[model samples]
Target: MRIAQVCNVGEICGGTAACAWSITLAFPDVDHTVIFLSPPNSRTVEAFQHCQFHSAKSITDGMIRHLNVDLVILHNSTPNRVAQIRSTPSIQYHHSMGSRTAADVHLACSKWLHQRTPQSTQVLWQPTPIPIQRTDNPSRNAATSLRIGRICTPDDRKWPQSLIPLYERLAESFKNVEWEFIGAPGTLRESLQHACRGNARFITADVSARSRYWSWHALLYHHPTISESFGRTVAESMRCGTVPIVDRKGGFCEQIESGKNGFLCTNPDDFVAAIHQIQDRNHLSQLSQRAQDSSHEKCSLSIFRSRFLRILNQLSLGDSFDA
Candidate 1:
């Protein structure tokens, strides 16, 4: 089957662009074309070399018809624009929070997001594919020093206003704890530097890279200000066997089972309590393994491929939708 994925492929890694790529890569047999709304950089061009790329400022029914694909997948498009397409069978793949498209069939990246979508809308759960494989054990040196880390883009909206206060509290509670912030910008790093007082290290790391999670015992994430539609980074960390202690909000709650695979915190004190529980080596190991297993079971590439193919079959793409 031929499919066209329309999305904004900006410089930032892993968002709608990554989701579109994952869906395309899932079906090797299907012909896929990516219609990037923004002009993609050289990195994006090299990364998505498997599929044909097209640059366009806006999407229209005429443009989609020109592609002559069996199906079209819309990502990060305006509601009115999404509703305007009438000739082609299209599906809106919602990736960001507060982004609702006017498509007949909607696919949300997490159960949390699926719930938030209007009950009237036909929304299906299509989780973001987390393609991480861990050959090594996820156990860490928790007895000596606890490595708490978080990975995200340098978006101020994702960071809580009370982040500095929360960091100070955590530093005071644990004597041997160190915090690492990956993908932090200079402005965010400056603020964290003042609060951490030499206890934190800010690194401008790639968001899609798995090596960033290796040294971390726990992914301590709290984004109370702006919730994620799908916590891709949190799930990725768990795939690497790093337990996530994230705020009990947004899609992060769906990825973690709370005290089983990982911990879900509501407040600063809750985060502290969760960290204290993982201080025990045995407990940490158990949670780490379970986190890895749960992540693989939930967001593995195989499951994503099956779900995507199933969606296409449901749409009556063709009789050869079996995979």
Candidate 2:
């Protein structure tokens, strides 16, 4: 079936754009078109040669109609903007906790989000493609310095305003650990550089590479100020078999079953203890395998395809959906 994935961001940077791109990749048999409300990034435009794209300042009913798509999926669109396409059969998708657009059939990306959303919304986990190469290091032993990574867009809003102290504490507690910060903001990186002198490595290059996700033995993530709606980074890390230690609030609580696949930290002390606990090579290996196994069950490509087809069937687009 022909589908139009409409998004507010033009670049494949944030979770909304990432999910749209992932959904496109998940359904290879379906014809997909991406509509970006903002002018798209040149690199992304060049890289995505397989799909048709539309870059516009605003989206309207006429614009969507012109695409001749069987379905229109709106990502993080404002309520007022969603009203413009009243005539179209569309799914208003919420990617953030802030999205409150009312629709007959809206979709939330996580169970946490679905619970908080209006009762009408359906939960649809974002599809994350598994890396073709397995990067799990089975030979890792107790002598190895556990590499813990933190990755996200270099935005202050995505970080805790006072995370320097936490980083310092983690650095002081484990001298042998390697702290890798991918896409850390400049000021944050400088502070971490100072506190974590030899123990830390701030990586500004190759932030989106799949290998980066798989390289980490564990992911240290905490955003007490801003809760993630679905925590795509945590999901991606899990897909790569990287155990994530994230804040116990927001969508993170849904992804991790503390002391199982991953750990959900409720406080700074909890974070430190969780990291220290994983120092055991045996425990780390078990959690990593469990995280990878759980990710396949939660967000794998096959699950996404089945859900997409189910949603299509519910929309009466089943006749057109060959898959």
Candidate 3:
């Protein structure tokens, strides 16, 4: 089927952009096109090489009509363009649905969003692929210090001032532990530099993704947002065999099995406690394996593609009706 995905392909490698990346690469068989709402960049152009790329402003309904497109998927749409179209099957594939309730079809990224969406809105669970393959055995060097990785938006929610005390304590108590944070605000960057001024304990990186999760023991993902719509990075880390110590609330609870696959922290204290729980290499290694196992079993690429194809088949069978 001919399909078009409209999204804001920003420079920052966010969950939405990552989801789009996964979709394009996984479904190359379909006549898929990405209509980027934002200014196109080399990064996005290269990423969507398999699919046709177009700017949203340049793309008219006539073009979609000309292509005989069957479906239009909206990603993070604030003011949906789907409302203008009456002939095509438009689905709001939501990362955040905002205030709108009435839509032809609403596909949620997580169960949390599905539960929160209007009952009248047709909600379906569409899990995001980790964009990486799972490793059977996670790597760990017993001779070196523990490596803890964190990738966040640099907001107060992700890198809160509240956690400053805990950071100080962790830096002081565990000299063997090294914290690696990526994408932080200038204030946070300066503060972290000051905090770790005496030693080389905290390191900041500017890379696409740390592929060394296989070597890392755990990923600390504690955000003040209470619950995320979906924890994409946490799942990504898990796919690389790195256990995530995530928050207990929201969509994070859906991703982690709590102690089995990964640890779920309640607060900063709980986060500290969770770290204490990881004492030896054996426990860390086992949790790492379980993390990858859970990711492979729960959020594999095959499952995503299969479920997506099944949805399309149902739609083709005239099962897609406005809720």
Best by TM-score: 2
Runs with alpha carbons beyond 4 Å of true place in candidate 2: 99-104, 132-143, 205-207
Ranked candidates, highest TM-score first: 2, 1, 3
Task: Sum up the clashes in candidate 1.
Answer: 0
Better of 1 and 2 by lDDT: 2
Worst 10 residues of 1 by lDDT: 119-128
Q: In model 3, where is the ten-residue run with the lowest total lDDT?
A: 199-208
Please count the clashing residue pairs in each candidate, in the order shown.
0, 0, 0
lDDT, candidates in the order shown: 0.74, 0.77, 0.65
lDDT of 2 by residue, 1-323 (tens): 68887888766756787788888888787788998878877655763557899877777788878888778888878765544465557887887766444444688888888887763358898898875444453323333678888888656776554878888888888877878887777767778877775788877623145456667889888875778888788888898888999899888888889999999988889999999889887898899999989988999888888887788777787667556
Give the poorly placed runs of model 3, Cα more than 4 Å off.
57-63, 80-84, 100-103, 119-139, 154-163, 196-207, 317-323
Query: What lDDT score goes with residue 24 in model 3?
Result: 61
Candidate 2 residue pairs that clash: none
How many residue pairs in model 3 have overlapping backbones?
0
Badly placed stretches (over 4 Å) of model 1 are 12-14, 80-83, 96-101, 119-144
Give every collision pair in model 3: none
